[model samples]
Target: MIQIANRTISLATEPFVIAEMSGNHNNSLERALEIVDAAAETGAHALKIQTYTAETITIRSDRPEFRIEDEGSLWSGRTLFNLYEEACLPWDWHKAIFDRCAEHGMIGFSTPFDDTAVAHLESLNVPCYKIASFEIVDLPLIRLVARTGKPMIMSTGMADIGEIHQAVQTARSNGCGQIILLKCTSSYPAMPGDSNILTIPHLRELFETEVGISDHTMGTGVSVAAVALGATVIEKHFTLDRAAGGVDSKFSLEPDEFKRLVEDSAQAHASLGRIQYGQLANEKTSKLHRRSLYVVEDVEEGTIASSSNIRSIRPGNGLEPAYWDLIIGRKFAKDVKAGYPLSIDHFF
Candidate 1:
């Protein structure tokens, strides 16, 4: 179990829900704080923002390498520099945004893209750090964040096991003992078919750390399914209104959808009790309705019991149905009436 700012995250508790406010703020600090308010109202445990500027993240060039060439990408044909300029959350707004998160009883943190960004967050004294999927390969940044001696949540999108091993090793070797791996697909507006969340448990087993899902799918279904598969955390991009439209709005969930995700994920986690197979406490009364041997027809004393008079029926206050074959030729000990429950004491 990992504790972050007084909250315990483990399979034993409800899945830690995070509302990613990534460029959904659209450069407006007021809107960003509003997103925080809305996320808290949706029962989100935390709100995450990305920390970096266009210059820090990319070069100001429209060259071929600087432009996103993938036709399937949401930012296709856009220069990486221009895209980051728009999506990067301003550094000056961190304190205000985090303060608002505190007002709503939610933890606030950011995905620092560079060592400078990490220092900025460290100054704010963030309780934990988040390593974005793209940054998992940045050993230096991982080393810096790990040395902070706080819990680290890393997204494993498009990363192979070897890459994950290096990131985990760097963090652990540097002093970050509390770690959580978020199984992510990395695709903007990723499809549920692509979200192989079964990897969540496998990740936990392989890394010996908490596991979760950073879902990009369209609904709460995949997130809830992840919870059942033992996801200790769930992160989804959040926007106040998809209709308003922002950089990440196409894949981001609206407030209502996020609320349902929280409710359903919690319920799914609660339902994953233990490996149990016997009748439960709630089933005690219902068990009485189970099929049992009963007298379907009248039978006089000394009469041989037969299938015509005895049968398996409901209301389990009788001999078990398993006894039917053995008692088939047994004699009735009394003048049993129709609808009588069959028991060993009722037969000779």
Candidate 2:
């Protein structure tokens, strides 16, 4: 178990929810602070933003390799440099945004893309650090962030077991002691079927660390399912309104949708009680409403008990239903009214 700003990340507690504000602020400091307030209102535990400049992440090159070419991609025909230039949060706004998060009673953190980005976040004293899926293979960057001795959340999107192992090893060898692995599908507006959240539990077992989902799906169902599979943290892109338009708004959840995700995921976690069977203590009254052997009609003293006179019915103040066969051939020892529950003493 790990604690992020007083919120405990463990199966024994409510899932720690994070509202990812990646590029959803639309370059407006006001909107970014609003996003922070909205996330806090939904009971989310943290607000996560990216800490990188376009210049730091990429160079001003028109090279073919720098352009996004996938026809189905969200940023198709856009160069990585230009896309990030428009999407990157300004370095000057970090303190105000994080301060707004604090005012709303929520912790704030960031995904550091490179060495400079890590150093900048350190100035703000971020409580934790998140490693983006695309950066999972960057062992040097992980080592740098780990040396800060803060908890790290690394998203495993395209990373295979070997790569994940190297990253975790790098972090631990440096100084990080608390780590979480988030199962992720790198696709924007990712499909629910592609989520493969069953891997969440396997991640925990494989790395002996907390596990979660960096959900790119369109609804709360996938996130809720992750909690049932032992996810201790859940991260989802959040925005005030998808209609307002932003780099990631196409796949981001609106405020109300994020609230539902928070509530439903918590309910799913609460429902994961220990394994048990048989009647429960709270069900004692309900058990009395079960079917049992009783006198369906009327019988008199010295009368022969038979199937027509006695049968299984509701209201459990009677001989157990299992005794029906044995009592069928017995003679009544006393008279019984139509509604009287059958008892072994009623027969010879």
Candidate 3:
């Protein structure tokens, strides 16, 4: 189990819903505060942001490999440095954002890209740290964040089993005992077929830690499905309005959609009560409506019971349906009325 602030996140608890406010503030502190308020209003357990500057994440290079030329990418034709510059949240804004989260009773944390970012978040006494999918291979950064002894949530997007093992080993050796692995599809606005949320439980079993999904799918379906499969944490990008247009607004959920996610994911978690086959309390009353052997027609005393007089029917106050064949040639001990429930005593 992982506890962030006062919230307990585990397979046994309700899903820990996180509203990732990544660059959706549109560079305005006022807008950022509003996003925090909106996120809290939606009943999300926590809010997360990215802590990095353009210089901290990448250099100003015009190399072909440094540019996103994929036509399928949202930032097509943009250099990595330029995109980071536009999307990077200012370090000076962390305190205000964290303070706002505290005011609203939400846990505030960030994804640290380097040693400097890690130290900065540590000074703020952040409760936990998240490792973005792209940074999963940065062993040095992982070790630095883990040294804080805070809970860590790492996204496994493009990583294989070996890479995940290395990252988890690094964190454990460095001091972080509370780790959450989130199955992630790195594509922006990820497709449903590519989500593969079934990995959630496998990740928990493989790493023996809490598992979740950093969902990029358009709706809450994937997240809810993840909870049913043992996801204990759900992180999705949040934005005030996609129409307003920000770095991640295109794939981010609006306030109402996020609220639905919070509700639906919790419902999905509640539905996974346990492995049970016996009738439930609510089902006890309905059991009477199930089909069982009943007398379909009136019969004189000493008359032989058969298909014409007895058969399986509803209102289960009768012999079990399994007894139907055995009772077929038995003589009736007493006259049974039409629609009467057949009992073992009625047969001789």
The global C-alpha lDDT for each of the candidates, from Candidate 1 onward, is 0.94, 0.92, 0.93
Task: Please list the residue runs of candidate 3 whose C-alpha ends up more than 4 Å from where it truly belongs after superposition.
Answer: none
| Model 3 TM | 0.95
Candidate 2 per-residue lDDT over residues 107-163, each given as its tens digit: 999999999999999999999999999999999999999999999999999999999
Stretches off by above 4 angstroms in model 1 are none
Model 3, 108-193: lDDT tens digits are 99999999998899889999999999999999999988888999999999999999999999999999999999999999989999
Cα lDDT over the full model 3: 0.93
RMSD of each: 1.4, 1.5, 1.6
Instruction: Please give the RMSD of candidate 1 to the true structure.
Output: 1.4
In candidate 1, which residue pairs clash?
A: none
Error of 1 at 228 (Å): 2.0
Alpha carbon lDDT at 179, candidate 3 = 98
Q: What tens digits encode model 1's per-residue C-alpha lDDT throughout 1-348?
A: 999997999889999999999999988999999999999999999999988999998899978999999999989999998899889888999999999999999999989999899999999999999999999999999999999999999999999999999999999999999999999999998999999999999999999999999999998899999998999999999999998988899999999999999999999988888889988888899967799998998889999998889989899988888998899998888898999888788877
Q: Each candidate's TM vs. the true structure?
A: 0.96, 0.96, 0.95
